[model samples]
Target: MKKEWVFGTVIGISLVLGACGAASTSDDYDPNEAGAEDIEPDMAGFVMDQDENRILVVTPMDEETAKEGRAMWVSEAPEGLWIGKQVEVWVDGAIAESFPEQATAERVQELEMSEVEGADLKASEALSTALSEADRENILAVELLAFDQQADQWTVKLKERGDSQGEWKTIVKDEK
Candidate 1:
């Protein structure tokens, strides 16, 4: 009787461990992988602060008592993503567990808007021109180009979205 019980217990333990390994969601993903697949934002929102080679998106909360907004991170800013522009992003992994959670975006898409949606046509045109004129070899992506009301300036920063040296530049509001 003791031998039968002990054997059964060992077999159960082995089966449980084997099942756990087989069911892992991250088997295809390595958190430490240098180049992980880009995420498509499961959460979508307006671009908040584009700082630190990441775009902070402010997503709305469903519960009234919950914080009015949640901030998520996107490693690469899609073409034409600027302050006030809307975007939908999907993450590669879970957001970092911290005071403000953040996740790396696998994919990003600019939300189309009608005129009533507060679309900035003039700014959009100008941005397109700037991007075309920029030195492609050096500037991988333009993370942000927003006017700072307090500073009375237009903040422009650039960085290598993939594999290049990051750069930052400030364009005075009137200088443009």
Candidate 2:
């Protein structure tokens, strides 16, 4: 009886220790690598929104060139995608203002669609009207990294050399 009791006590203690000594969640699992079933059934923004500014195509470079330039950029936030008539950049709302081409949007709609392919029609016209519009201060395709308070404008942080070959980051601190 004494032998049996000692054996059971040892097994119970071992089981408790084993459960207690289990590693923490991160140590035992990868938070970044989770499956659909593991995640909450209704996780908003779980499919993260794509960052449009990640690829800054400075106007004039065009999409093809911008695609090519992504490889050349370092720091990743200071470059621009040069689309034919404009450049695009990532900017916080503070210093940079993005006004939709509401005026020419109708004009773009008026353009004949027969000559344009369905995939390219609307954007092509919108882009064209946006470039030519009277209101177009023509801010496009560049990773604007800073909004300087003193100058009252966004500052471009381009990667001109070595490891710093991309846009570092941008700041638009001026409120509205």
Query: Which candidate number maximizes TM-score?
Result: 1
lDDT of 1 by residue, 4-103 (tens): 9999999999999998888446657754478765544477765645565687665533335533445566775655546555678777767786534578
Model 2's TM-score against the true structure: 0.21
lDDT of 1: 0.56
Model 1: how far is 143 from its true place, Å? 24
RMSD of 2: 18.3
For the record, the alpha-carbon RMSD of candidate 1 to the native fold, in angstroms, is: 13.0
> Candidate 2, residues 1-176: lDDT per residue as tens digits?
99999999999999999999996655455323556124321101000011232322222223354431221111133323322222223222222223211111000001122322222223323333323332212223333233344554433332322233343323322322
Ten-residue region with minimum lDDT total, candidate 1? 115-124
